[model samples]
Target chain A: MFGLIGRMRASPGKRDELVALLLDGTEAMPGCLSYVVARDPVDADTIWITEVWTDEQSHKASLDLPRVQATIAKARPIIAGFDSQTRTEPVGGVGL
Target chain B: MFGLIGRMRASPGKRDELVALLLDGTEAMPGCLSYVVARDPVDADTIWITEVWTDEQSHKASLDLPRVQATIAKARPIIAGFDSQTRTEPVGGVGL
Candidate 1:
């Protein structure tokens, strides 16, 4: 399975808004197995997104979905910058 | 929910061993919702562990489990070092 783990920093005071937009955008992806949005416990403006997909191609294709594109456009303003990003190969786990 | 996201580096040529040990140790976790082990695509010796639990106490308590303790002891020798660790509050997601 393909996985992506990343840390994103929201614009000051907009973390919750950013998370809402992210969760709202997750409704209809075809190959997504798990998509989790979490808030940094200490850093209020930081968020972490963990995603598991059936394959790399599925994850890439999701970006072209109209809903995803719209969500990106809507969230762009509130997103400050991404801190770290890692692509992974999931072998086995509870969620998989 | 409580969440933990971290990156761990295994001893040279021991990444798969570490992954196997971790997966083996996952059974019987009481409040764990998800525990995913993924390998870094770019770095052969690195791993990312993403976990979601019902609460912080459940996570803390898990360390005392005999199986978990054994896994930790077994894995300690092959674990090179931990790179990053983050505590998170998981609000909503596909798995949880």
Candidate 2:
């Protein structure tokens, strides 16, 4: 399986709004095993997203979907910037 | 629950060894809900670690444990540096 761990900073007080957009975007995401959006307890403006997909291709494909594209368009302005993003190959896990 | 998402870059060619140590370190960790270590598919020397604990205090306490201290000591030299770390509050998920 493929995994993605990304840290995104919301613009000022837009953290909750960004999280809502993220949670909304997860709907009907094909090939998604798990997609979690969590709040950064220490940094109010930052959020962490952890995703598991069937494969690298599936993840890439999702980016092109209309739903995803629309979500990104909506979330672009609210996003301050991405701090870090790492692509990972998941070995195994309990939830997966 | 508390969550930790961290990215670590290993010394050149030591990614696998570091991953081994991380996996070994998970044994008998009290209050640990989930601990997953994954290889970076794009970057050979990087690894992503996603951890969940009962609470923030439990996560902090794990750092002081003998086993954890020993693991940190053993793994320190192999680690190149940490790229990013975000402390998160997990709302709900499939695994936990």
lDDT of each: 0.92, 0.83
A79: Cα error in model 1, Å: 1.4
Fnat measured on candidate 1: 0.79
Instruction: Looking only at chain A, give the TM-score of model 1 against the true structure.
Output: 0.97
Residue A92 lDDT (model 1): 77
Off by over 4 Å in 1: none
The best candidate in terms of lDDT: 1
Listed in order, each prediction's TM-score against the native is 0.94, 0.71
Worst 10 residues of 1 chain A by lDDT: A87-96
Cα error, residue A20 of model 1, in Å, equals 0.9
Q: State the C-alpha RMSD over the true interface residues for candidate 2, after superposing those residues.
A: 2.5
Cα lDDT tens digits for candidate 2, B1-96: 898888899999999999988887766778887777888888999888888788988888989989889999999999999998867887654345
Would candidate 1 be rated incorrect, acceptable, medium or high by CAPRI criteria?
Answer: medium
